[model samples]
Target chain A: MSLLAAGGLAVGYRRGRRAPLTLVADVDLSLAAGELVCLVGPNGAGKSTLLRTLAGLQRPLAGRVTLAGADLHAMDARERAQRLATVWTGPVEVGLMAARELVALGRHPHTGWSGRLRAADEAAIDAALAAVDAAELAWQPVDQLSDGQRQKINIARALAQEPQLLLLDEPAAWLDLARRAEIMALLQRLARQQGCAVLLSSHDLELALRHADRLWLMSGDGTLRAGAPEDLALGGALSTAFRSAGLHYDALEGKFVSLQPRSGGPTVALHGSGTAASWTRRALERGGYRVCEPGCERAARAAVKVLQQGWELRLGSSRRRCESLESLLSALAAAPVD
Target chain B: MIRAQWRWPGATLLPGRLHSDPLQRQRLRRALLQGGLLCLVLALFLLSLMLGSVNIPPDEVLRSLSRAGAGESAWERIVLLIRLPKALTALLAGAALGVSGLLMQTLFRNPLAGPYVLGISSGASLGVALVLLGAGGTLGVTLVAGLGLGGSLALAGAAMTGAALVLLLVLLVARAVGSNMTLLVLGVMLGFLTSALVSMLLYFSVPEQVQAYVNWSFGSFGTVSWRELRVMAPLLLAGLTLAALLAKPLDALLPGEQVAQGLGLNVRRARLQVMLATAVLAGTVTAFCGPVGFLGIAVPHLCRSLAGTSCHRTLLPACMLCGAALALVAALVAELPGSNLVLPLNAVMALLGAPVVIHVLLRRRNLRRVFAS
Candidate 1:
């Protein structure tokens, strides 16, 4: 069931024959068919290194990576490419090669030495383009593509490879928020429909958590943790890997937010439900107030209540009613501490 | 909109799709371009034969070309024995250099790269310098006697050896260094080292020997006699064949070696083949034509810009024809058609090619599109 398996793998650059400078040590990972696994980590957490090692672009410092139960490194590029395809981050230098031509390169393992694209190859390229939602870009020069468009084409190129296991390194690193989510969703659909395992590394935690069937968490300490996305998020593994001193993972929100920084300021209990409470919490946090007891109106010590009318601040004998979130923040700021 | 029209050659014209007959259209268009360029090459070839120290009429030139069994006239002897070989030499040299430059440019992914970017010309000069200046009295290859049997053969042989050695060094460095830029810089450094060695040889040689080396350095297409063409033609053909075979892999390489390897190419093997191809094309041309300049570096760029695409399938043949056409033009310019005096070949090439290079540098078109993905 495992399309790709990396067992006790150590990734690093080698210096002659002595030993390699191992960056990620003893990584045990497996990708099954028809699955989407996203690799997430902080900067310099060896995500690219682990991905590169799995892709067979670099020699692992230790251990073995097998594709279809055979040693990955031992296979020729053509044979390896047939089983495992990787899409690296772009801007890929291209000399006016059409997006379709770029995708057709994926047929190298299937085509003859002359690299003439056949009818089947053309079909695969068209299917790939359509799959990645880049059908219109098929005839455009890859050199002239926008970054987001280029990333879509890169995915299409990998799809055209027709590999059982697809790996990508930061495929949407440069896209805007909406495009990032779209790319992740596209990768998930590609895995499900194409019946190929797709493994990609990304720093977009929200998109990764929302779309990825499973998660591989690479930490700064060179440890790789893998589990279902929700399991990993709730299990505190994602937070441990990515959340630094100033950042904290909000499990309910499935996103990261700034840690309150423990300012010795007075605590304010903001009480509300839905978007109002969330925005009030954000404003209180931004206003330098330690917003505690969220949605707990009865907590007593100076608390603000969010009624349909507005924000009613009750500060020991001094009550202020404000309508807008800005006025409420101002009142909260100008109000005396209990 | 412009990008769409430009990429029509590679558009995915799937069967029964809206886009129709791209392969057929591409072939027809390519045929037309090739026909036009081939005609130009022939016209220039004829012009090359007709205009020289002694002018021959077009009718006479054709008469001699067609009726070979007739009594050889002064014009026939001149056209057949002298002009025909020189023009063929220029044509072959130009084609070889053009393809070689295209390969080098693709290999290095640098536009400034040419056949001599790898110190091949300097190596050939080093070879000729060693024979002419270092061992002048023994070899006895005089500037006037350069076209003679013993001297010309020895000079060409020495030049080829020197070129082979430099090519071998470059290929060696290319194998060791992973980066194309590093290999390219190493080539330039190798040129400097060889040039320094040649300067030392020049300082110690006699005046007559120095004069001979200087004249050889001036560069010429007419240096290849009929005997040399027999050797140069086959070698250039082999190089051209290698370039054609490498078209697909080289297309994968336009993005660079990493992508080529990703496309299931054996990068090391492809690079070795490219180097071998360049060594043959560049080395043979340098041996026969004294390092014909500009055609190698400029012709491919001219063809690529005109063709509006960098598909090696189209651009390779285009480079060949453009290279031949440009070389013939350069040959004509060097001949100074009306006057008996001939200009130094490099001088004319510089006058023509330097502007194009400067223009490309100034215009800076499609550079980042090729560099940044």
Candidate 2:
């Protein structure tokens, strides 16, 4: 059985004395135990709305959400909090709170009226901090933490809640590439090891594709397409969902494909393979050079060969060995534009 | 490797938990500070009793306090009849305002929020103006008299009713206003509106009634008699009890309203409880003490900075203790100790309170740490 399931749910906001605005509707989603799902969409495509609806923070306009065979919305807040937790993208304002104290707050539902942490609650907090590799930061004030550390501490706080289902709205929205990947990996590990269902919305499609167990892709038209990452890519759902005039999804490469418009004056026959060759292609493209294929290489005005140590630039029978991509670009610039 | 243990301010090393637990160390330090403040409050309370317009010796003051119906000497009469009630009134008012201020700050998530800052005091003053100035005449008089109350009791009832009404209005407006800055500005505007109404009422009153209103507006703890304490103490105690019960909800609300709700806190009900506590505390104090300023806004900040934590469980008690101490100090200073000349209570409070506020603001980082922006 799924940990949480939503069927025929419609989410929207009501204005004063008017019809409610429906941002998304007719959605069916389920999160299974120990499964990690990534909710991916463009900005303002109702990702947060759907996440809020699933978490039971907001009432659904149409249908019901069930958790463990019971209606999620019908449960009291404390009961729901015991079963599920949510983390938001907005920065938390915690004044003079240490990392441990903040994480311990996630045990809110389990604690008594005074919120005194029992021994069990303390153990949970310690385990959560260790889970996020943030035990060293337990004593540090939250305001003094780096952005990456703060995000980890936030995740730890949610973990301390000991929920069967966790929902996060864009938890990795503001982080460096390394930190973003680390967070994704951590979430994946937590879901597997703790047998907790994890669902998070993220704009980092590349990381989502690589690390997410399954994908719930919400397109610009407010329709959700859920499947395995590779299956979605192979079915052309990713391409259609993220379609733009200037870009297309590269299925084989598992990334977006777009090139700068050629300068229309300089044409270069570039030859290479591997990482260096791909980077050189990007540099040449950025420099507004038209890189020719095998058929057009012999007829090109400028030909560049990717060698073992350096780039060999040949322009009209004159050869120059450029040490780097920067030098190669400058050499092309110095060459006559014809 | 040997672990380094540096001492936090005022922290005493307690066995079992004090070795490496920073949380326990913080608790110990807060306890030390509270203990010191309790001593200071006692010392100041004794000083307030001993050094009034007529100076009574410490032994004499203690004798008068310990022995009921002691010899009817001038010193005993001064200590028992006059200064004891005044000192008790200061302590109660200070504590009420402090806790009220903390609640307002947390409810709105604005550091500058207080009963006076949010115009709740002005609402009370407006109620008193209607009664004392006879602007409402038979309507206000009959309203209080109908309840079998007279004199200060009528003023207390009218003031509390006005405060509750204004607080109700503010809470309604708080729902509509999203920004804390906007809510504070609206509160200031409400203050201005109520004060203007008060001024208009004062304009039409007779000279004798106007003098009574003016004297009350100067803000004094000495005006509350032993009879009034009967009414004031229970109301303030009830407010304090209610605030203590809300400590967990207030801590949960520190993150934001939505986050608090997600934490299983009933945000709306908690908010109403907080407002109710604020109204009772601020209104009862204002009705008796005449809109005493600075203690409400300043005491909470003092407690936060001294304790270095915003956890309401710690803060509520700290505010109570620190607030009582500060008010006693202000009352003692306003008494002018040796001389018969007395300074205005509000003037003394401003002289003591404004510097603390300025110091908090100028530090910038402390201000950031106190408020949830």
Give i-RMS (Å) per prediction: 2.2, 1.3
Best by lDDT: 2
> Where does the lowest 10-residue lDDT sum fall in candidate 1 chain B?
B10-19
Distance from true position, residue A313, model 2, in Å?
A: 2.8
lDDT of 2 by residue, B1-373 (tens): 2345665533464475675687777777777888888888889888899887777778878888887544687887788778989899999888899999998888888776887766788999888888877645555445434422256677777777777778888889877775556767887999999999999988887666676677667788876778889889999999999999998899888887777877888777787788778888988899888888788888888788777788888899889988888889889899897788888889899997788767865764576766746
Tell me the lDDT of candidate 2. 0.84
Once all C-alphas are superposed, what RMSD does model 1 give against the true structure? 4.5
Residue lDDT tens for model 2, A1-338:
88788899888777768998787888888889999999987777788888888888788888899998899989999888888888899678878788998898899988999999899999999999999999999989888898889999988988898988888888978888998999999999999999999999998889999999999988868588899999999999988877753457889888976643546856788887889988998899888777886457666878888999999998887999999999999999988856
lDDT of 2 at A295: 54
lDDT of 1 by residue, A1-338 (tens): 68788889888788897766777888888889999999988888888888887888888888999988999988888888877888888567677677877888777778886788888998998999999889988778887888788888878887888889898888888788878888888888989899999999998888888889889888778788889999998988877876674568889888888776657666788777888888888888777777777555454457888888888988877788889989987776776545
Model 1 chain A TM-score equals 0.85
Q: Clashing residue pairs in candidate 2, if any?
A: none
Candidate 2 chain B: minimum summed lDDT over ten consecutive residues — where?
Answer: B140-149
